[model samples]
Target chain A: MSGKLLQVVREDGQVEKALEPRLSDAQLKELYKHMLQVRLVDERGMLLQRQGRLGFYISAEGQEAVHVGAGYALEPEDWYYPHYRDPGVGMMRGVTIQEMFHQLYGNRADATHGKQMPNHYSWKDRNVVSVSSPLSTQIPQAVGTAYAMKYRGQRHVAMASFGDGSTSEGDFHVGLNFAAVWKLPCIFLCNNNQWAISVPLSKQTASESIAIKALAYGMEGVRVDGNDVLAVYRASKEAVDRARRGEGPTLIEAVTYRMSSHSSSDDATRYTPKEELEAWKRKDPILRFERYLRNKGVWDQAWADQLREQTNAQVAQAIQLAESQPKPKLGSIVDDVFAERTPQLEEQLADLQRTHPEVE
Target chain B: MSRELTVVQAVTDALRTEMRGDDSIILLGEDVGLNGGVFRATDGLQKEFGEARVIDTPLAEAGIIGTAIGMSLYGLKAVPEIQFLDFIYPAFDQIVNELAKFRYRSGGQYAPNVTIRAPYGGGIKGGHYHSQSTEAYFAHTAGLKVVVPSNPYDTKGLLIASIRDPDPVMFLEPKRIYRAMKGEVPEEAYTVPIGKAAVAKEGDDVTVVAYGSMLHVALQAAMKAEEQGVSAEVLDLRTLVPLDEDTFLQSVKKTGRLVVVHEAQRTAGFGAELVALAAEKAIEHIEAPMLRVTGLDTPFPYALENQYLPDVPRVLDAIQRTVSY
Candidate 1:
């Protein structure tokens, strides 16, 4: 399985020259910085949750390359229907750290007005649709956006990211089948983290690989080294190009591992073996990218250390700013249910206001 | 110019009218394009609008709805047909969780302007699977406007209105009367607002409230009660979510009695909400206990569907019971 995967940057700080993406040194550093920022956010988010400052937190710790690389392949005009673990996609699309913290705090400045849980990012201006809790629901939606683009004769593509667990959902099959038949401009990226909470890939599917499922739908499928940022980006860039060229959809299976617990609510030690976690940590995405950068003669220990300090300070400042904001107004609870509040919502709002006069 | 049309014909007319006016409107469903829909409600649409606009989708309800939500978010007004209301269960999660909550969940950033059309109710002997009026399921979910039309005129009007609505709407067509019911529908397009109720017949005794196929049943019951010297006011609650509570509540207040009817099961049906509304708002004006004429608390039967659905006699009986109480 490892031999069949696409690899540009090896774990030992070497790259297959032919497979390496032609990114400039500045672009490469930005990618590394974004991955580092994602790691820092996860670390601080977990600590905030543990310290009882945040209600809940979900992290994309070890799999930063999968999200950042795939998301970087998408243009700003394209739409992204992200899985819960793909906050890096939002960050790459210009969702500020402060905005993420506001969402985590469910403050008045939050885009969703605290309607959704923490880590469920939604930025309409950035063409990033809201993230839902249910798995694989965004697959068909991504295809649909592609359908709209194709119908309007536009070249924009829509990409949906999910985990290995989502491959079993009905929407996954339906979305792939529809996209294949219609030749819709869409991309389905399966972040095969090998674990869906407590359920392992063995129980999730008997298929040889998640990408191979694309063959049954008459579409292209590719397997990539998830920890290798260059490989993920190359694969995703090819798929995005094919979609933009109206060549239909492609399914990219990025093999990775969830090094952290499923979320703040779970303990991976209860099910995940310690040796397995240790093995995955050795192939950590950030470390491998660092090695690749160092081998390219564009990285140093002082730069890396300073980057960490700046990211941590930025995360701390965002937490403070987000925490100082007040919760959403009580009257806003009934708002946004529709374009305009109906009589029922108005009556309910009045009743709530009457009952809690002190809040207003 | 007004032409006499059946409910199904009016559905085709409404789709054609809307799609012709708005190029951004896309119709996707199983058999909607080449087959012109299983019921032919989309007859001749694909030929006229081309396959790009009238798409014949794969037989996946969730895919149809989920994709439609995506299309709506991307600036297209998507109208997806479920083929049958019973078959919509596969897409229930999409409807309830995704389509219904996109606006509120996104803090008004994304409003999925989609109209999901499904033929519902139990009078055509399609049995349990083909004939189940589950509008209550959608009406119970907030951020969704549920509309059911009883006649050809209202069908075209309400369907047009639902498509143009800013939020998602569940437009449940009464298949029982899709062809059985007919009326003079206007040639030009018109919109019968989503949250308003129509008084089919006015009277002074008891208010018989219904929508879709049951509206005709209530009308028949009212006519029968008229001969029996018991006046019954028939109210057509076309939209269940943004319920025209004012019309029904005012009628209940004036008539001093109420009788609700529907083809769905008795438990947790839309009738229960109507009964509760009347009891809570018009209890002081009521002269008799309100009653509901609804299907039994059981699955719509294959052998005894007539017994399962609330008919004219059943509605008249409930009207009589409420009036005499």
Candidate 2:
């Protein structure tokens, strides 16, 4: 168990193996840019919350590479069930920055029309299912989708991502057991951010690692360095390939840290010590990826600074567009309850209109 | 063209007919395959449809619902049953949060054609765990349809309709009348439209609204009311959500009196919703204030089961109070 966890990049910017020669320069740059873009998004969201411009925000922060890497590993046809903190994955799966801001601002342009809180993003075109707030509920649903895929004889697999705290949920157990029993084409990617709200991972489970628990369900479990982008991508690619080939599900536990409070409403300083937070800050995923690119002679300080400025500008413009949009109309509140509105709902909508007088 | 069948037999007959008519329809639950279900509701389905269509799932209710949600999303009519309604609590989160909201949350992109069948209500002496009137819970949840059938004929038609419906449905079969009640059910498949009420008996003095096993008790009370020269209108509200407010409203408007009955607890029961609807829609027309005959606000008791359930006397008392008022 001690030696099984996989790591490709060390903290000192040393690679155990040469991946650059095989990975095209464009793909490498794209992966690096995605990680940086997600980081920029997270940081700006926190600032927006501080300024009272946004109602709520939950940043992926130090865990951007894991999400970006896993997102890059799947095909567009595959179904993805993401946790609430996977805005990075949402962006990769065809959710434009403008659309994400629409969700963040909960404007009329938002697909849910502010029905869900901010960070709840879903795109049906890319097969990204809407995410629920309940812990680990996506696990079994993902397995079910995978089972359906198998039943229909489709070659595509289904992937679900979650936090370490989600592993303790009953849905997680049910999902793993059902997937294994039926040999469904599914992947369970657990981003072990080490903290669920205020509770640490140690208190969450007595088991040494979340990955090892997969063995009890008769499935393969792999622990990867979540901070290392290449390692996460490689592991996810292999699991996705295996699933497409009808090899059933694999549970991949990405070992990383959460460098921010749980959400805008939380204060991590109360529970997480300053020293621990400071120590993890040095292992920041963005910093490590920048170093890795520099060592490979593919990046420099000038290019890095220019890229950050361009990405920040792009994010700022999206926020501006999102903020300028008008609020949702009151009539839409009664809409989408079902495919077709019941007469009772139509009457309720009429009542709201009658009372408001100004809304259409 | 029709044969007399009990409620439990009608359930199996509907499953067999539907599975034959539609290849996408399947059944999954604990012991539903080889054991023919606890109440033999799915008897011989595994043999007729094979194990793939009639799956025997693990004893995880959440998994059953979760997998069914997936199957439905994948374009199959997935009907999973809980052996008893009481065991469905573990899967409540999946049903309400995931299955119920799939169509709405996805902004109508996907509708989970999943039907969860459970046997509920108390007259069988199964104690607290086996007997519970939990329809109100599902009925209260938005984007979900709730149906309960008292007689075998309605049970078959409603179950068939639920299987074909493009949304998630909670089909609660009254366990008490599973065998006690029998009616002529059609041999061929047919659908009873959801969200519509059936007039069990037409009268003009008082409107008595009930469903599932309580409908039988309501009928008895109405017959006794007839002996005293009082005409009672008995309405069977098969579908609680998308409720047929028109049928009951018209009846209450004609009679100028209303009495709602159910075996669920008093507070926030389906009965409360009916009474509230009456007061909201036809308050001015009603001659007497509406009354509800419901089970006490207590967990179903083991020893005093008869006392716990709302009986004919309770319904009669409610009728007398409404008629005399």
Candidate 3:
């Protein structure tokens, strides 16, 4: 593990010329647009939750670069096991705003069919595993998938994302140890947002850094400035390339902050210091990426304004479409419990349908 | 051809046969590779299939099951052994919440084709942590098929069926009878349909319902009851989740008396579900109150294991009581 944090763009958006990735102007603009879309959608989701139109909301307000940059570095063949705060990753991988909205509303059109809570998106066709609530559980699952890939002689890699708090879980240790021992093609990304429902990173770990913890597992560890999109993409691309070359797993710790409250139910004001929040807001991922794009002559005020309007309009249309959809049908309640419904479940469903004829 | 084999040997035969047929089948556990498992249920499998398909994983139950779920999601048949049913708690959340709910929670997008095999029940004098019948935990959770085989024939057939099932199945082997009981088993690959029960013995006075090692005790008790001039019918419930209610209900209807037996705790054991099923569906045909013969409501003890588990004498007593009632 290199003790230094990898940074391609400084806080003022000035690039470290030697480390800056050689991305085309169009790709640069695309990255900024992807991050901006996440911000706009998250804002609308929060407002909807506050207005009682949605049940709950969790925003990745300050960690856009971490998810989007890393997601952009992967190929479509790679499998992603995402945490809840990964809407930006899904967007980079072809998840439409309408699809996300449908999930948030838990409408019949939702891919998960109202089974999981809002923001828990899953696109099986895109090779994205469903988001589970339990912490660090996906770590071992990702390793297992990577193991299968290696056994089948497939070149594809498996990547799993989680927060700093998840690093403390037993699954985290078990997963890393197994991957290291087997030299599986996997990537462990820690989105160090620094807060897990009001618990700070200090309370979560006493180590020098989350990346350095990988040394114990005998895997390569890289720490990057997660607020810098260029830095995150570079680190993720290198790790993805290494994994594809059969060099085994890599642990990438993208350090950033969570600018929003934990969820719709949380009040960040109760624990977060006012000054600390202000400091992180100035170094916001979107603002930093906008400066970087402007420095490259790819971003202008008019384009930024137009993009915001277009994105917000898209979000509005998606929200309308999702809200107009009906809730999942009553019979669907027992539909996917197994490949085929058991006789007992069939009897229970019959009883329910018989009693609630009006609902059907 | 048919040959005499123990329950444990039948398990090995089933895994070896399945692995030979399907290259995608992966066998993984703590001591599965090179060690052939602590109980030798996977004996000679790693040598035949090689280490890539037969893996020895780290000593973490959650890791074993979680990884197996991942493998299944990626279109592989993953059979993970928990070593013992007592040590499955660490992976309980993964099994109950993740593996069981993957198909439903994904809205049918992803269904984990995983079959978790574990050795359960008492009588090995393993005591406490090594001996427990925790099938009720998995049986209570939907999306999982809980299967327990009492004999060699059922062990091989049911295991093959569980591996081929589209959904996750919990295959709990009774360690007590893993080697103690032997029966003729077909060497060819065959599947005994899941969600079905077998009538081990048929009689008229009372119906005795049991599974796993307890089924052996129930059969013995039925024999003793027959000698005592009391007719006892034994029903071996192979699968508890998708329980064969029709078979048991028919037996209760004919006998007019129900006695459920299990080696799990007395409170809320699978026997309770059987009793409730009889009461709800066959209440009119039942002549007396349904009785449950199960382990006492306490942690499995080290010194008093014989007293802790349901035995032939205890089952015979329950049958006599239910018959006379």
Candidate 4:
């Protein structure tokens, strides 16, 4: 096969060999269900942030299939560096919804304390490097991990996910070029949702595709229909296997759309039109996957009803856990600053204490 | 015996020693591999260690530092390079946010054992971007151990120590002094413990403190002031964060006068912080107002960077002001 850019597991529930990974009926049902669950989570998170019940957050509602499918394909040992917009990606990698809620609530039990605004989540032991606020910043980091994997003689694959907008950053080019030259075991996945902040994909780059940029860096570039969960998963899995085999890095552009604003801070209505939104709503990844499932006999109303209840209950339980978690302490800002506090930090810590002793 | 090598050669030696000592220690940055680094800091490191270890990464500052986080998290010692300390603005998020916060965020479950090396200070003809001493910015951040070495010996020692440190360190090497300076770094390997102050010279008069390239100027200023019978004690603060505040306080108690010096523009440089600290803790020990001799508050001039930097004459002039006060 040239490469498995899996788009549909089957046509009319019949096996489609060349188009996508020939998934067993069970896996197909799982992908569709996960995409729905994640999409709901993404929408609810955005709504909660807007209602002032939660802090600022980036929603991945429309990009669920891009990450869920790709994320589900990963091994637990593989490393991930998800961006702020990739809350769903982390979720698929087994980061609990409870931890995600604590992240938004800025609770003491939160992985990153309250230092980062809502959406920054990571666990080092999980091999998920903490995400940075800057765009394309994690690309080189994934490359670094891949280099280490090669050095240590491990088959570990290092993957990073970002949006199309990140490609404009110098870090993206530099990271790809370096990985390509070194043959590092990494898969650079770009969920090209078409807009970075407000800049559309057409304005972001003149390249034929973000993945094609990989060609210049001496890596394979595969463009896939990102809204199709199977396509994203198959492309990512193939790239991942190549990385594990020590062939080199691969750049995958999962062409998709963002159904919502960039974040709670943004207003998509300013740039995106209602008509376009309506058009995209019809092509929703969740809906498409659902239709696919129905054709495969896995979409009975009873199964859909039970899954919805289970997912909503799980999401609610996570939110309740996050709410019950204690708020992070003010002293946390001063701690972990360094192994030893610098004189300057000591002064600041002192100043904070003197002014806000009750915070303790 | 004192010998000579450029500041560049001194850094090379430091990296070479650290790399040889720890297999986990790896180098990454733009042009650091076959290009031997833009300044040749890793001139032959790639060939010596193989590309796997001495990585020449893409020209992505954020990526460079971010990758270091991954490398360190995975149990490797990472020394990510910024071609110049000034170019670090692009990676500010990584340095200030992630590299500094990892351990704290993880509640000590993780320590970002990484060193970010960059050439800093002024007087080189490379104009503003290449010559600015941007150490104070890192000094202001909480999680990073910021250090500036003035001599080859200290450079070798501190770089070794920083590489071994189980935290993120911003190792600011004064670019102007690279190769322009030389010292007999002990042939054998050893490390300088962080959070210690070096008393460059002993005196009872006002104590003058400096770091990085400014240490050279401060020492010269003290020498020139001696002609006027003013015995200025010079202290070099190799590490900015995890400061030797006790040593600084002790110096203030004895000298009864304090003057902190640095090449970063004055508003919020380490000098300002040092003066404030002295005021808070050792106000009674000061016979005169704690003074700060710093770079002018302006964009570091491209042509007359020599004029902008705190030079021997400028240091001596500040000493005159403090002594007269």
Candidates sorted by lDDT, descending order? 3, 1, 2, 4
lDDT of 3 at B43: 92
State, as a TM-score between 0 and 1, how close model 1 is to the true structure: 0.99
| RMSD of candidates 1 onward, in order | 1.2, 2.0, 1.0, 3.2
Candidate with better lDDT, 1 vs 2: 1
lDDT of 2 at B121: 90
- Candidate 4, residues B135-244: lDDT per residue as tens digits? 77787776888888888888888888888888888998887778775678765567888889899998888899998888888998999999999999999999888889
**Selected candidate, larger DockQ, 2 vs 4:** 2
Question: Could you tell which candidate, 1 or 3, scores higher by lDDT?
Answer: 3
lDDT of 2 at A31: 82
Compared to the true structure, candidate 3 yields what TM-score? 0.99
Worst 10 residues of 1 chain B by lDDT: B316-325
* Top candidate when judged by DockQ against the true structure: 1
**Per-residue lDDT value at A33 in model 2:** 81
Error of 1 at B175 (Å): 1.0
Which regions of candidate 3 deviate over 4 angstroms?
Answer: none
Task: Give the per-residue lDDT of model 1 (tens digit) for A1-360.
Answer: 222899999998799999889999889998998899999999999999999998899999899999899988989999999989988878887789999999999999898998889998899999999989999999999999999999999999999999999999999999999999999899999999999999999999988888888889989999999999999999999999998898999999999999989999999999999999999999999999998888999887898899899888888899899999898989899999999999999999999999998875
- Higher-lDDT candidate among 2 and 3? 3
Of 1 and 4, the candidate ahead on TM-score is 1
**Per-model lDDT:** 0.92, 0.87, 0.92, 0.80
